[model samples]
Target: MNSRHIYHVDLAPVLGSTFQPTGFPDVGAATFTRFEGGQKVDALLVESVQSMANRLEATAWDSAADRPVDAVAGLPWVRVVRAGSAEFLTSSRLEAHRLASPFVHKATVDGRPMLDVIKEKLGLAKDTPLNRSAMARAVAGLDPFCLVHGVFFSHKEWLGQPKFARASSAVIEAHDVLRAISGGRKSDRVRHQLGEDVGGTAEGYGSVPFHRTEWTAKRIVASFVVDGELLRSYGLPEPVADLLETLALWEIRVLLTGGLRLRTACDLDVVSEVEARRGPALPELDELTGRLRELIGQCGEVFGDGEPLTVEWSSGKKG
Candidate 1:
């Protein structure tokens, strides 16, 4: 069976033709051109790979509870807890580098440095080369999310500089894109102007006007890929591999159904059913949800029997 799964979905604004895309501070919209069927077409990057990775991770988290959502509750992840209390501070799923996050590696767990604990758990010695398969299994037990989205450990102590590439990735782009330029004013009801006495508009004492840039596209598509080949390279057991793949699909389903409101002005809705261009067909949301819970159960041994690994942390613990 083909291991790689590729999905494409058509999208459109929920209310109007114009929709705002992710923008950079100095560089507004990321606009470019590409050839399609021998014709050059204008396109705008609505969401970058890095941004989509974060969004996908967000699908599995419940911000209100500060824990994994119900569908992925039992999956392994690291938690950095308050020094003297069990309260949650941050977790692997929320950290930018997963298990390698500074908040995780720098803290102490039961008087032992978290970094040293991880190295010992992963069977890493100062002078040894990284064993890809062994480390994959070790990481799975620590933080399965890293196996899904990848992580890099650049610490000087880790001479091997181990890293994994994302097994699943997604990006959103608009084709035949056109700019929708508009402007609005931030009204100051209390004070229309302050001149130099109160630092004027720079200090927010006066009405300020700013330009807005949005886009209207002939078509918008969110493309996703799950690399089966990469997953296999990890040498994970059958159950763990299945869980990761299903977890990825589950993430996509949740994002399409409920995470479309990317920004205040960028609300979107799927215009057509998800299309799988390669590998197995996409499963229904309910089916994936049920399967994810079941798979999490089957891989209990891989995820371990302990609560989320906690590292004691405080604001003053300098690296």
Candidate 2:
């Protein structure tokens, strides 16, 4: 099997409720009662902190400490969790933590807005506010949810076994739906219109020269199809194909949340590695194609089919 490194990161928004030093309202009441009954809350607090610290240390040391530095460094899977004030590096302690630290400006993971990250990563002018808005609008116009699905489908092995197949199916189904919607035509005008409709741009929205209409829905859909094929070429089960798509979508979410957007080609390489590992499974493409077609047919039946022409017309009308 092609062994590739996969990184999964989750950034959970912190609510006021979670920040309370005490567990919760009920827990606080229980603690008060315990105090009234002469029980020590200090001991409990100490135990809880100790447990948390131990868990953190264990997680940090889990894979990095035992494996050779070069081997661990090159392995594909990496996961980082950013929740509230704490950042947890689930896979590689050194690398994951290093990548995560930049996000932590001051006490909070610099929620400077995902747009800023996009601008910086893409090398947009610092003072170009209107251009930034236009770029942001363009991205927001595409189906944001599918980006995560794409990531999952592109990186199947990273997903736990139990969820592998179902996740793959969902992504493949979504891909079929998107493809049918786009009619396989990649038009800059169509993409620009999608960005305007989905992202809401104003008349004066200065255009970011790098922001092309082609970066919208059609490109994403095309990437999904290519990634799906690549996964199938790996002799990975349909489930794995689906999982990588989901991971792609997830990576999009993470990038967006961090105020960033990725080049389509940049992400495509991330997905294509699976196929590169074992070489092309082109001889098996016919079987894979048939399975995907069957999956698409089943999905249409379940989700309610419409004439592709009619759907395209409706999309145009809506746009």
Candidate 3:
């Protein structure tokens, strides 16, 4: 399908009406007005697209196990390990840039640098037509998440740095927002005399108080969209395409069920069922998980040997 799959869900604060929205360094809360129908409505950005992307990926990883969760157990990814030991470091699944991450590309796999391996596998050469389908397939073999979340290999040595826009993206926003101002104090129990060696505020010797601004919103919404057109453009096989889309849906399900704690004060819960704005209704989580396992098996050949492609990182190497 060339059309996009768009979904939206209503959300509410887990505790109370007042919740904290993401803030910038000096801008405080990002509040603005947008027209809905014919009237202007106050709006606040709960979470940005970039932040939501990170959250979505987090749902697929099990930090305690240092691997993909059960739902995505069979996906291929590059893993970086400490040199002289099998100690886990990082992986394409967790890295923001996926295969393009310095920790992946700058390290060595099977005695060959990953960057060089990428070039050799993709068969990149100057003055040659960029075979985007081949590039997509190659990346899919390394890390399918890169296909779903998108990636850009921007190293100077990489000829025609391949870049793919995110096939799935999401953002959380609130409407009819009201500011809730609060404050807290960091009290120093000990008092210091003028002649004492105790230092100033910078040395944690003084009581510091700070003002906090939260928000009370009439309604909050988390919107997700999967670009079917862009996904098809990758020219991936049907099974691979289905796997990526299912992974995207699974991420949304997990995030809404448990990963909505954006910050200490920004906890949220999905108040209503995930409503589809386009395409078909989302499948049940159990169904999706089962399908994922089957698809992983069907697409096994496209992925690297079942084991992760390990990169041995040594000291003094810049990554």
lDDT of 2 by residue, 171-252 (tens): 1000101111111333344335435445533443333233311111111111111244433443433443344343333333
The TM-score of predicted model 1 comes to 0.95
Query: Of models 1 and 2, which has the larger TM-score?
Result: 1
CA RMSD of each candidate after superposition: 1.6, 27.9, 1.9
Q: State every prediction's TM-score relative to the real structure.
A: 0.95, 0.17, 0.94
What lDDT score belongs to each candidate, Candidate 1 first? Answer: 0.87, 0.25, 0.86
Lowest lDDT 10-mer window, candidate 3? 191-200
lDDT of 1 by residue, 282-310 (tens): 88899999998888888978897635887
In model 3, which residue pairs have backbone atoms overlapping below 3 Å? Answer: none
Evaluated with TM-score, which candidate comes out highest? 1
Whole-structure CA lDDT of model 3: 0.86
For residues 149-189, could you state the per-residue lDDT of candidate 3 as single tens digits? 98998987679888988989999999988889899998778
